[model samples]
Target chain A: MPDDTTPLGAPLTTPDGFVALYRREAELVLRFCTRRVLDAETGVDLCAETFAQAFRSRRSFRGATQAEARAWLLTIARRQVARYLKRGALDRRAREALGIVTPVLQEGEAEEIERLAGLAPLRAALAEELARLGGDQREALRLRVVEEQPYPEVARSLGVTEATARARVSRGLRTLAASLELRWEGERP
Target chain B: MRILDELEREIERVAHAAGEARPRRRWWRSGALLVLAPLLAGTVAVAATTGILSGEPVSSDPHAPRDPNAGIGVNAGPGKLLAVRAADPAGGPEWGLRLVKTSRGLGCLQVGRVVDGRLGRLGQDGAFGNDGKFHELGPEILETSSECQQPDGAGNVFFAMTSIGQPASADPASCAVRPRGEDKRPACPRGSLRDVFYGLLGPEAAAITYREGGKTVRQAVERPAGAYLVVRATDPDRRDVGWWSPSVTPSWVESIEFRDGTVCRPDERPRRHGRHECPLKGYVKPRLDIATRAELATPITVRVGTAREKPYPEMDRKSLERMEWQRRVTISFRARRAADARSFYKLTAEIPGRPPNCGVGLGSPIARDIAAGETVTETLWVAHRCSGTMTIRIGYEQQTAPSQMPFHGDGPPNAKVGTARVRIP
Candidate 1:
């Protein structure tokens, strides 16, 4: 921890601060990587790659607080996720170069990630939030977010213009984002 | 199972190696990164911090109030921060904002945030650095703060903002994160954690409402202070954030609902209270093809100079529609009269766009003392938002005093000896 007079955030210039950041945010990045691509093993690779990339460009980080750090990390992680989705597989260049190990998911680890991601309870809250939105919004969210379809496809499916489809999905997602505020502590059932 | 442990060691190795490779730079601050960060993430943090920076109006310490943290109000006689940290409408579980009241006659606004709260980081660095959330990390540990410089004590707005930043301390990557092997990783939520505007509305204020993202937003102030407005995004987060280059546009306030209510426009609490002319029906921001020329009263002449783009990183703008807007501009003044001696001269650009009251008004004028008949070129940035036959009229004046020797000093020289215009198509 920096002294009271020292700047607010972890300097990340030192090894300890950088590692502290990883120890702090690795799991969230793991979940982000795993849930987005829906694979535990790939999530592991992404987690490693994300940290490696972060370490490489640690100086590029300017946030003095952990919030800014995480936001910065998430941007990198999101790009990592985006890249993974864009390509068929994770780009292991960063991880491989760093000689980081990608752990195999134990038998139940995959299910654990699903649970950690809180997809079930999240679905419940989402359903509630979705139910509250207009039908057009809900369907638009379903096609764009759930199905992960492009705006054009969503628009065609909704028999609306692409712009209208984007509006619905955007509105739906925003309303649904409120669900993020909720803690998914429910059971597997 | 041991993924993070190894990664932790690896992180140490790399961070150490990289830290050694490049000595830590003292110049870099979180604000720079926040400016570079995505609109939602960086701007939200910045906007909140900026609100806080709009320091309270009162300057000159309040005659050593018995308790600085005592409950303060409008008539409290040069009051200070109240010893209160309630869950304001604008605040979350962590973030806090305080109005920069009149202290030493300087309105000091200090905005605070937990994670990406750049302003919060300032407090952390200042007297209130690292209260908590440093040792522990998860998705984020939020702590809100403020930093504001009121324009001649005009903008007396108060706001406390919040955002979900890093994760909790527990490493959810660990399979055994919870009792049932359940991992709760509060990863960065999809879609940026938007901003919430909350703070003490003045005692005299009633309610506030304004326009945001093509929608009219209203926030009614039931109490004297502590009313907030949560501005949520109306658009869906781009699913593929792998690569996105956004063209920033200057956001403006249309009309404000005041006098009837205590609240100010959502953009922020204003220095002046009155209905504004805004939200022009079917308003579309215009883009100007800026053309340049040098109309000067020589021994100074600008050659074929270049215009380089400067990143516009203003702190407030949650309402700006995502459009291709010129964020900042650095116009270069080049003149090589085959030098004799380099002297100092100032350059100023003025524009009167076709339609007035459009984009942001004239940016700060550039003041450079160029020695004529010298092979010299100087580049300075100016921020402007008028979109019509935009004219950049350059004029210069000689300076004798040392105070005006620096880049920004206003003396005489108010004639358009030369003019350059920009076109909006």
Candidate 2:
């Protein structure tokens, strides 16, 4: 991180900083991209593209804390994922010519980690429950839990207040838990 | 126990991964694109300009004159330059105004460069009366501020007396540059000095005039009301250059003082608490004319609406019905070709209100050109209690037309044009 005196300097060294950021937050970024793209390799590519963009624009980094940095990084990742959706694979070739690769999150390691954390079973049920909810509610839950952003920051990104952000997440969690209960009964119970 | 042990193992593994990812290099090279961007941009701009200059044809300036229209004895240099005190005053709070006498008796008044409040000049004779007079108009001592002079006094500096019959007060002690010279018109010293404190402050001043029976009086008035003098300079070629002060209501001016040797000063400052003569009625009517000649088949538009076409009836029926009343409104035309000559067209709208009328003045009426295959728009008002249908009879007369059919012609009068009536219900 830059010392207190330097207003213009980056918060941290470029390459190491981005790699550390990837290692710390890669799985969350992967899940975010997967939720939208529905393919493993595409998700990995999007995640990498997000990091590559973040690295190039490091001059604009303005994070006060690690949590803030994670929020900013996720915002960048979301933009990269949106561009990927807009242009598709043909755009990938154009982006490559521009020296931009839409990096993908490797599926195996992220899946294995989620399984070990006991979140693997929840993923499909959560996605279904989230899709059923209103747009704002689903966005709040994804940003707070899956992306691991703080409540106030998510509220700001969604143009809402902290209390509203927290309330949406809580309501989404309850609805999700009820949906999972029904799914479990329909399957193995 | 097995599940708990698995959770602990997973947490440990995650910790190990995160610790290993900690950065080893404190410094990393930034992307390659940034380093050579300036050099690449410079090369491109130079090449593009070179290409443009090598191939493009040189052309004369379109606005350049075919014939020189230079004025005799007029040098290309700044005329009648004033320093326009770009800095704020040093210490005092009193606002001031300054003016230079013109060859004509009335001079151009510059207000609001020195102080806060504003005052105005009598524009014409009898504007105040047959004999111009000033009265203690608005309220007294609205606010007080420090009046300052320049440490290195450069220009003519003066202060506003509180009223026509009051002692001129000095600005407060806190004002940085105190007036050190004699009370008479003081000269500001040259070069930088702290007597006026630090740098330039504000750019505002005021000039106020008042009449105290048997004497013409003037003062440099200032107010903390933070008033302004907005000067709009109009450059009408060499023939004319004029300035107009933004119109302000009389109630806004708070103080008045006469200059030295004017019969309107007292040893003591007086309270401002009286009314002055109200602005007079009737406006100065401007004279105008319309010129026409033999031309093409196209019709030209003229504004019959003149300054005399006041909304508040310019003439009563007794006065207007007997005399042929005419007014000239200003209009502009574009010349398409030298051969395609044009002439002025005249139109007037007549309507009757109460005989003795008082209303806001008439607005300017616009004119239009009649292009072939294009419709012309004209405005008309209905005269009351007479004809329910309004008929606008447009007529034209050419100086070159023969005695036969002097005013009217069958097919768009060659060397003459005449009017046609369009009925409005």
Task: For residues B1-425, write the lDDT of model 1, one tens digit per residue.
Answer: 35556556556644653343232111112254344334323222223332333111112122233222211112223223333332323233343333444322212333333332222332221111112222112111111112221111222333323222211211112111111111122223333223333433433444445466678755554344423433332123322111111111111322233344322343442211121222211122222222222434333333322333323343123212221233233344444221110112334333332123232223233322234444333432222333343344344432221111122233334333354454422
lDDT of 1 by residue, A1-189 (tens): 233344324466556678778887887888777765556677777887888778767644545567667777887887787666533456654553443434455577677766666556555666677788888888887787668788899999999999888788767766666564453334211
- Worst lDDT run of 10 residues, candidate 2 chain B, spans B239-248
Note the Cα lDDT for every prediction shown: 0.41, 0.33
In angstroms, how far off is B145's CA in candidate 1? 33
**Candidate 2 CAPRI assessment class:** incorrect
Instruction: In model 2, state the lDDT of residue A82.
Output: 56
Range of the 10 consecutive residues with the lowest summed lDDT in candidate 1 chain B: B241-250
Evaluate residue B365 in candidate 2 and report its C-alpha lDDT on the 0 to 100 scale: 15
List iRMS for all predictions.
20.6, 32.9
RMSD of 2: 33.2
Considering every candidate listed, which one attains the maximal DockQ?
1
Report the number of the highest-lDDT candidate. 1
Task: Please give, for residues B191-232, the per-residue lDDT of candidate 2 as tens digits.
Answer: 111111111111232333333345544334332221222121
Fnat of the models, one by one? Answer: 0.27, 0.00
lDDT of 1: 0.41
TM-score for each candidate, following the candidate numbering? 0.31, 0.21
